[model samples]
Target: MPRSKRDKKVSLTKTDRKGLAWKQRIIDDIRFCVEKYPNIFVFQVQNMRNNLLKDLRQEWKKNSRFIFGKNRIMQIGLGRTKAEETETDLHKLSKRLTGQVGLLFTEKTKKEVLEWAENYWAVEYARSGFVATKTVTLPAGPLEEFTHSMEPHLRSLGLPTKLEKGVVTIYSDYTVCEEGKVLTPEQARILKLLGDPMAKFRLTMKCSWTKKDGFELHVEDSVDDNQSDSAMEEEPEDDDEKEEMEGDDE
Candidate 1:
């Protein structure tokens, strides 16, 4: 039996409607995020966006899912629920979020995200020649021990430090190893490549067995007074004629 034309048309319309509804549901989810999350950080990748997109695509390929949605839709989606409670005021965050944005929805920890941000900023800082204004305090310890532990790593990175007022101060210009000592362009490049001066120093000390190397050797344990005396006694007698001739020449 042949189906009626009206029945076929009605069935096709129902299928089309269902498809459109599903599409709208996804878009609404994205819109909620954009509207509610005032702290949405818009990283302006610009030229680098393609690289990020490629990485995301690769990850999606492996995981069989990815999120690439319209900003407006995400803004609306964020407003649907309180994604994360914040101590910062919403007004301040809203001002910061007014621009292009790419959403990153992940299960990764905040620390992991912060670490990635730090590494990214490190590269940016190197290219722009920027230094952090923050200073970290170190606990009390032996000056010689501290210097020995840190100096080699700093030297390797071409960054110089000095013990001033019982604290290690990094030179104003990272290009120089000693304070007020100008560094060549190559030195600055090396220092930039070495990121985080303190981390590098700690790693170097641990790898190089600096603690053992820095331990002081006692004179009594290392050498005998009798041996020293015998060695001193073996010194040759001064040739008086030769000494007089040398003195006259001088």
Candidate 2:
């Protein structure tokens, strides 16, 4: 039997489906963090190393939480222009999440986090096309580690090499790269071959936010390293003296 028009259910239209489902999920995640942690920090990374990051998560599992991926969604979750949306100061962190940045919700104080970021470092092979931080020079001597067959490949990297009785020998000191110079394919390959790792992995506490401090950016400024930049300007004092007396005493 056909139902009456008033009895029919209202169907959702395209406008109802305008937003992705995950956006709400991200918002909920951000809200949960606000309820759970006292302070939050943001970190920007030059590259991603899954194993190392996983280890860090395990180590800080007791006191910290790491949120990565879907940065834009998370940014919107925190609030963009105003704090009224989230009803918290989390919005202040949105501006600094422009690049590959992640959220760190932690019970630990800001000083502890910043110290770890400044001191904790890892060394890894420098990728091709990155600038060489230092010069890689191979002295004129017998390269007993490499066989004679590798002579051609070594010379291809611009090293003056010759095979002497089935051994690769460098005729003179060969400079593979210069400091502050963009490394070429050959230079990177030779550096790795020589087991000279130049790249140092480091993290910076780009910024942080909290209830008492509001928002702070860890930039080089007049403030000392021991101080946090989150202190906002003092709010106007309430002129209660000019107001008429009201309710009863407690």
**The candidate that achieves the highest lDDT relative to the unseen native structure:** 2
Best by TM-score: 2
lDDT of 2 by residue, 2-109 (tens): 877889666567456315674576567676776778888888765445555666777777767776645556667676546334645465576566555667878888
- List, in order, the clash count of every candidate structure: 17, 0
lDDT of each: 0.32, 0.69
Q: For residue 7, what is the lDDT in candidate 1?
A: 75
lDDT of 1 by residue, 1-250 (tens): 9887777434555455324464466455434433432222223232223334545446534212223333333333333122321222221222222223334333333344345544542122122222332342323333343444565565565445665665555545442333333434444454444442411100000000011132121112322222322242221322111100000000
Off by over 4 Å in 2: 1-28, 46-48, 83-85, 147-163, 220-250
Cα RMSD for predicted model 2? 15.5
Off by over 4 Å in 1: 1-25, 28-48, 60-68, 80-97, 120-250
Candidate 2: worst-modelled 10 consecutive residues by lDDT? 241-250
lDDT value for model 2: 0.69
